[model samples]
Target: MKLLNVSAGKIQTVEIGGEKVRTAHVKMPRPEPWIITPDGAEGDERASHPDKLYAFARTGYGHWQAQLGVAPGEWNDGFFGENLTFDGLDETDIRVGDEFMLGEDVRLFVSGARTPCIKLAWRLNQPRDFLKTFAASRHTGVYLGVLDPGTVKPGDRLERVVHDPGMPSIADVCDYVAGVQAPVELMRRLLAFERLSPTLRILLGARLNAAEAAERAGRHHWTGWRDFRIGRIVEETPEIRSVSLSPLDEGPLCLPQPGQFVSVRMADPSGDMIQRVWSLSSYAAGMDSYRLSIRRQQGPGSNWIHRAQAGDTVQLKAPAGSFVLDPGSYHPVVLVAAGIGITPLMAMLEAHLARENAPAPVHLIYGARRPGDAAFLGELLALAAARDDFTLTQVYSQADAGDWPRSRITAGIVKESVRDTYIALDGRRIPVPWYESDIYLCGPGDFCDALRDELVELGGQPGHIFSERFEAAGMAPGEIEEAEVRFVRSGTAAHWSARSGETLLDLAERAGVAVSSDCRAGACLTCRTPVTGGKVTADLGDGSALLCIGRPATPIIELDC
Candidate 1:
């Protein structure tokens, strides 16, 4: 491998999304013989103290540019916050435990792949969708651990001193990090790699244990589809409505835990079936029906649901999601929501209140553009008034005249809410210490990310916070490249292009191909299928792609459909 460029920089403050954040080398320059250490380049800063030496690489930039139709010189070296840009090195060929001799004496060991964070998107001035795109691209560079810290410079020829044949490639490790389900043996092999970070090892071990437990439990996985009838429809707001559903067969409905979502399928104006997922907004231990509160958006699915009346029939699948309350924990809970995001959190709050024993105190901070846009406000207010364990803080971003304070939910507001000894709800001051609470965030992706970063800055444990997105956020239009998709099982092929603006599922359906799918948003993993050849970009990082949110990145994509 030939080192093309070496760069380093100290932490500097930059304004992003109207807030100042500390970032390193937004525009790093190639430096000659830069000092290298176990932590990182001498001047670089990262949260991980003495590990995760290298930040990023430029190996995949060429592929990204070709796929995205970006012009030359539109992006430069260090654009991805990477310290190293190399030539003639295949990123996929590098494996964990591979030792490289840098310059004459400096030795570096491959540790792991660089996990893309929100900051990288901010640095690139890309939209939020860029995060998923980068992960799907699988070119996120690699991290290195210094075995013999020394000076390394541009034009330094890198010689491989060692390679572990049993180890997985950085791409494989990245796939695992992106929520790909690995085989038990693969997990064990990764855990045994001595050069792997301790934190990563622990995570792999946990995943292995969980997979084993699930296998032993013999849990019956839900497949196929079921039918439901809308029992009631209530207008919650001018643009939002709550639909109550019941099984058509009069059988028992599947009980979903709080914060879980169910997939709903309906026909569009052209009679093409469209599938969308909505969170269960209310929870009753033995209820016979499920409630989904939906806000009308520009999409056809939401608009159709908004116009539907009671007694309308729809197809639905079982609830599937990992975003749920920790039943074993007794920690105080803080639920944060914006606009219609209050649905799932409401279910969680109700579940907590229904506990037989004394439950931990629950606080909710909800925001909306106006008082009229807030859904379930009356029910939430009544619940808070009736229970001492429940408290609510309402924030409106565009309220003209209101009794409540008008403010946007930000990191500052979250920190202030947590530090206060008592929470102010309406005119009542409820004594509650929220600093020690576990946080649950739901809303637009950008809003949730900002709140999460703030909470972490205020000493909140990253693991203690949970979040879910209402929809695939930041769907922006861009140039699309022409491609071909081949279905292995069906012995058929279809043409696709960026201008089609349709998911693989939609394309397949139009081409008379049958693929089982439920939630098309990449959350439920219902449309997951392996790509045997070529490349495809998706919203999620698993080895398989969600056809609902997947697009071709190469000239030809072969799917094991």
Candidate 2:
């Protein structure tokens, strides 16, 4: 590929799509004889960063002209915010770790595809849907890291110095980023490339691990209702126990993603099968069995599980849940847990630390009624001691003199934990902005809802804050008020009472109306159904109703279920 033009830009504010955006590379001009450094172009704003110090290269203007169906000169170099425009090499020809010789001395290593953000849509003055179309086109261009720094001018010849055949092409990376599912083998190959972006590698690695777990489970044909023998049970706290189980046939079991859960079915005294979903607390990698930390509740499910002994067999479904860590996100993580909610968060912590070149630091805030109620106190302390990037803060609502201060995990506590500056374990003050971190909340419904609402009130985006509750956490539907819900596709209607404490999906199931669902939480969109008529209230705001998490706001609701 021949370098047709080189460009750079300084930080400036520009108006795009009627919005003012401050960006350093708003309009990169073609600079002649650009000086290249190990960080990036000498005058470029994106230089000398560990993750994004590289330059971006896009195809020539002609390629965009044809793809966008625009007139000649309508779009030119730097329109897509690229630092370098090349004539010959397209995104399809570039692979992670492929090195290119620029001019006589400069070398650039292909890192990964540039992910399109809202800024690009604004820059193009296109509708929000254009972002989707742009990504689906697989022409987002590629990012290059400076391997051997030197100087280069316009018209410099670009030659391939090295190529790794095993690496996925830039197009493949784009496809993966766009939510296209890839085979396990392809994901593994992508993870093998060292020069690949850490974000993408971590993402691919997670996918590979999940796929391997599924493969192991599939080997034993373990699907639907299967018998799992209780392998071991250990008391975690005075009221909590960690139960380990393995397939009855002694076959390999699929490891669940951190924060995922499995449904366990046990026969009650009345000979009726009772099922309960519990979070898997243990890490998934290289695991032969599944482990769940259960708090002894008064419910029949928990009571039976606690009474079970080793060598006892119970029926269970394969592990599944949508409340999983986003492997693609590089932001720091804040895991908030209260009481037994620590189960899933512990799994997430383990998974994050086990990753190669772990992407971001983790801050864990856990609270319980007392020190004796903390389930994984020893394990969490050990993990905090081992990893410098991990910070643990414990809160006890009812603590003795020797225990932690009697402080409940409230909005105030959360705010303090995410402050801009905090004293580190080594006594050094560090600046860590909590708003930039992804916060995961798992605990009692009321506790989680209160914290989630508080975070949003504190300017936290709903999308960045993930939550999972063991039971319904919202306000109780006072006094029985019957509401009629009509399913358009199924031609079935059902009457639901606000006091029933049932979601739209629950009402549908009771009325024998079929609706697709997974996760049962609002995280997965599988249960999202359009509301053709009437109105419904939901914790999520995606225009459509998440049946699993939605309740009728109006007396008569129409669903396209």
Candidate 3:
């Protein structure tokens, strides 16, 4: 695609995880070290190319090009001081070594994908444009690392070295998706492909797989969806629910591996929404539905679950977590729970209790606010009484108890209870169980951390400890007073007084500018700001990155945000 008539765009949008980010706005070329930034790029971002300047512009934490005025074509709502915003030439299909002679001598080649950081997903104005960008520059854009960097003018003849149409390529994968159906093995192939373009690697592939499964569910494991209200509302606590679901679907239920989890996908009453995940806690019981222990909360997409009715239908993805039972029983299972941590535990316990040699029973240690705060109290007591293999201990730190303690669970107590054999938290262990025996865990972050630390110090191997962290241990006021940065796009200069705990995404959010972000976890690759000037260290072994999660540390940092 060729673009003409481009000039300058003001920094119209900025944000962090949809929140406005605020910092002392300073001039460009902020300062040295440029390395100390809130983020860096993912995948092959650091691997620069000598072809596409657009690709290079998209690489840094924040990127900008020297605009020598404007040229050709009159489209673009957000200027962002851009260089080449074009049309035509099969944009997504461009590749490295493939050059296009643009206005003047400015040339570009497909170098890499512009994996996004949170900055792109942030909301703007009232938030209408947040989703619009899904199809904007972030979507229909590719990076061009400059080969022979030169001044590019508008309205220049843009010619390209077009290759034969018919050739085995990842680009073909995009066509498959746009046409009839995405190949069942498309995701697998993309995952297997080595060093593919950033665009194809992320969007045309990663983001497209599960999405394709939803769009076309032929033979895909996630195709068989089910979530029916089966039973009455057995009970309800202040923040959670105990629902008994009888499988409404009459077909035989598909049995999953013990630890595998199911994804609960639901949309809000408002049409604009996305999906979220949840776990199932009951063993598969034929066509009849089992129990799902859920904690209702006020978050992005959980309002519906809180207000769900007894007979309300909910769509469920197939079971898919990496924690579960193995072929052979290890030994002396040790299960622990903090709050709702018992979800997977219940399912696992049901299976283990049924097996003849379920790894010498379990040393179950559960922590709750009070003995009465336990959710599955009745079921738990029954398991202990009915089988000699199972032993139960409870910690009701806030309440008194019989045989149960009046203190929170401690490593000392747990260590004494099941120090001898392999332990299972809720369900049985899978993958590498107790050096083949099994050690499993799942719970809130803080609880999991405290318990895991003690166990590890007691000599737990890396793979030996399997666990999951749900919520933040807590969200504290950011140490905003410690961050320092520098912007390097147009000119060179520096800024100070930035806080350390602050993320570039958050800074944008506070500034009331709309940046993009989703799945704040580092994986999704949205919210990518180019590192035009300085560098920033990211938590993910990868270098500088999306400001949404990146914490600024270095004395000076640069980004395209």
Candidate 4:
């Protein structure tokens, strides 16, 4: 593989069928190019280092789905870009954190794997696929964040360093003989891989360990102190229980930022462990233990919780989610939640309360069917009463005799409740934040969508709206496929064709087009393209593409951007 032109930012245009085609936005910004200066002279266009170059990932596909008007499962393919495309040797053996020599001296490493988002589905039209790919092997492939800074051109040969196919590679080899029923040779092929390299030996050892555990337990389970089992279960309402879990082991429960969730794996009727996730209703108050004010869910896990007695061990994982409490420094944060979504918010309020040492002023609104339906009613009310800086209000829809009025959360209700506090929702916003407050919105899909709309009209900023939704979080094989593809930026025209098992970056460089991308796993949008012609698909949620990563759904296309 040789060096070629390296371009960064949102793909301006995609060339298809010899005409200019518009590509959708991949909710990420473009990357800046490396400008090198010899000695102390002015920086030049060539690469600054012989070992590395900077680039961006195609985050477009994921961004597309966030477009409210788009339908689910619309975005088909995925996006990501790279400085060099690879070929000659099979690539299934690549592991993250491993490096390689490309096109002479350009050193590349597998920094991480690709993980896309739903924004793509809402944007270009594939929300479910976006999530699936994120958790599946399709999210595989190495993401070389950056190894060294250097200028690269076309016709460079890629040299492997510490070449090894990690578990992901062996996993693929075994897939051929899995549930579908395949030839015994497929098993032989996997075994053969075991002999090719010592790395393969370690890989097999790891797989066998996982497989054995799966066999004995009838499933794979991750054992960790992530599950938080808190205090005595007291029934405060018809459907809610206030139980608390503390940091039994150490490290502060990791005391994750507010709005994070932990996956709890439990046993089924047959005694097989199944997994489910729940958000922490309360944040780390003092690290003594965190609380989970849970409403009874319909699943077996929840049933276990409902039936469990004191001292029952509840397996848990630490907090995990990007919906963290914003620093609340850049802008005031506006938090919106409905029903059970209040769990994480309480943590945030507690955090502020601790900092201020006094009741910090915060605007809080909650909705429930009735006063009886409200869980943690006493706790929330107590917090409000004690903290003069905090204001708490409830809107109930069910017919009930209570101090609060019965009403659903309508735009008028939300507007009326907030006298002048900053707002936050779960995800990106539409109308833009009038107060420009960082908005964090969480809950079910409908709540997110509805609140997103209402908040926009209220001047919610797009960048300020940060949503955390739960759907598919892991990936399965065949869910996302890697393809041989190429992207060319020749003059103003870009060309592409079936790669026949080559990396997109290598092919583009060969064709004399340059791409500036990073984490070429289709998560970041550093290598997005502006489709001018031809048809392209993506799992990331963008309409156009990240030529550095995505494989062509159709065989041929032209670009003029």
The candidate scoring highest on TM-score is 2
**What would the TM-score be for candidate 2 when compared with the true structure?**
0.68
Better of 1 and 3 by TM-score: 1
Model 2 Cα shift for residue 343 (angstroms): 2.1
lDDT for each candidate structure? 0.73, 0.72, 0.48, 0.47
Worst 10 residues of 2 by lDDT: 421-430
Compared with the true structure, what per-residue lDDT tens digits does model 1 show for residues 1-561? 777776666666765544444556464665555777766676666432224455454546777677768876687776766677776555678887899898987888887776554467766667544765676566877778888878877778878889977788877877776667778898888767777754355345556755654463234334667888998899999998999998887877656777888888988778898878899999876767889999999988898899898988888878767777654444567889988889999888987787544235777888999878989989988998999878787888987424356788876666555544332322344333344467899998778888898877765657778988766622233234888899999899999978778888898888888987757776656677888887667734455777888888778889888
Error of 4 at 411 (Å): 2.5
Ranking by TM-score: 2, 1, 3, 4
- Candidate 2 RMSD to the real structure: 7.5
Q: Could you tell me the TM-score of candidate 4? A: 0.43
**Mind giving the per-residue lDDT tens digits that candidate 2 earns over 367-422?**
98887899989888898898887888888888842324688887667766655422
The better candidate by TM-score, 1 or 4, is 1
Residue 295 in candidate 2, Cα distance off native in Å = 2.6
The CA lDDT at 547 in model 4 is: 53
The C-alpha stretches of model 4 lying farther than 4 A from their native spots are: 1-231, 247-252, 328-331, 357-360, 400-405, 422-436, 470-561
Per-prediction TM-score to the true structure, in the order listed: 0.53, 0.68, 0.44, 0.43
